[model samples]
Target: MTKVPNVFFICGNGLGSSLACQMEADDVFEEAGIAVNSGHDSISDAPSLNADVIVSASNFRSQFANTQIDPKTKLVYLDNIVDKNEIKEKVLPVVKKIAES
Candidate 1:
C-alpha cells in the first residue's frame, strides 16, 4: 500500500479554510491512491512537525511568513480559500507523486 502524504494546513486565524483544505486532500487524494491526514497548525508549529505539504488560506496568507518557512517544505497558497473541488484538483498531483516515491 502506498503511504499517504500528510499535509499541515495553516491560516491567519482559526477559520474554516484550513479545515476545508484538509477535507479536500482526503477526498481527492484517497481516490487517487493516496492516504491523507491533515491538521490545523500555526506557522510556528510547522517547522517542528513533519508534513509532506503546507497550505495557507488566501486571505490570511502573509501570516505564513515564507522566509521563516523551510524551503524544503512543499507549499500551496490557495486563492481566497476556493471550493474544495478546486483544492482537490490542484493538490492531488503533488500528493500522488510524493506518495509514490
Candidate 2:
C-alpha cells in the first residue's frame, strides 16, 4: 500500500493553535478528496517530525527559517487558522501533489 503523506501543523505550543489548524486541515483535505496523515506539534518539535508537509501560522515563518527540515518537505503558511477558505487555498494544491505521488 502506498504511504499517505503526513501534514504537520506547528505553533508556539503543541496544544493550541497547531491543533486547531490540524483539525481544519483534516476537513479541508477530506473535502478535497486527498488522503494524508495530519499531526500537530510545537515549533521546537517540528524539525524532528520530518513530515511530508509542515504548516504553520504566517507569523512562524522566521522560526523555521534556520531550522533544518528535510529538503522534500513542503512548508505552508496560513493567514488564519480558523478560516477554511484560506486553508484550502494555501494547502490543497500542495497536499494534492503529495497525495498523487
Candidate 3:
C-alpha cells in the first residue's frame, strides 16, 4: 500500500478563506506526485486528528500561545500570502523533507 502523508490544517472559526487554501494544497501535492491527505479543522479538533504534521493558519501568534505542541509534529505557520502558487512554493520545501525522509 502507498503511504500518504497526513496533514491537519488548523484555522480559527473554520471555513471561509482558510479552508479554501487547504483545498489548493490537495492539487499541489497531487501534481508533485505525492499523495497528501489534508483536512481543515479548528484547534479544538487538532488533537483528535492525530496527524503526521500540523499546518497552522490561525495566525502566527495564536499558533504558539498557551499550547503544548508535540515535538514530533512538524508544525507549519502560514503567512498572509494571497497567491496560492506562492503559498505552495513556500510550503513545498517543508513537505519535501517530510516526504523524502
Give per-residue CA lDDT, model 3, range 28-70, as digits (tens). 7787888677887777666567677776663744645755666
lDDT of model number 3: 0.67
Q: Number of clashes in every candidate structure?
A: 0, 0, 0
lDDT of 3 at 89: 66
**What tens-digit string does per-residue lDDT give for candidate 2 at 24-72?**
8899888887788888999888889969999999999998997888888
Sort by lDDT, best first: what order? Answer: 2, 1, 3
Q: Output the worst ten-in-a-row residue range by lDDT, candidate 1.
A: 58-67
Name the runs in model 1 displaced over 4 angstroms.
80-82
**How well does candidate 1 match the true structure in TM-score terms?**
0.75
Per-residue lDDT for 1-99 in model 1, tens only?
A: 577677777765435766766666666666766667778776666676587788776655666655466667687777745466667666767777777
TM-score of each: 0.75, 0.93, 0.77
lDDT values of the candidates? 0.68, 0.88, 0.67
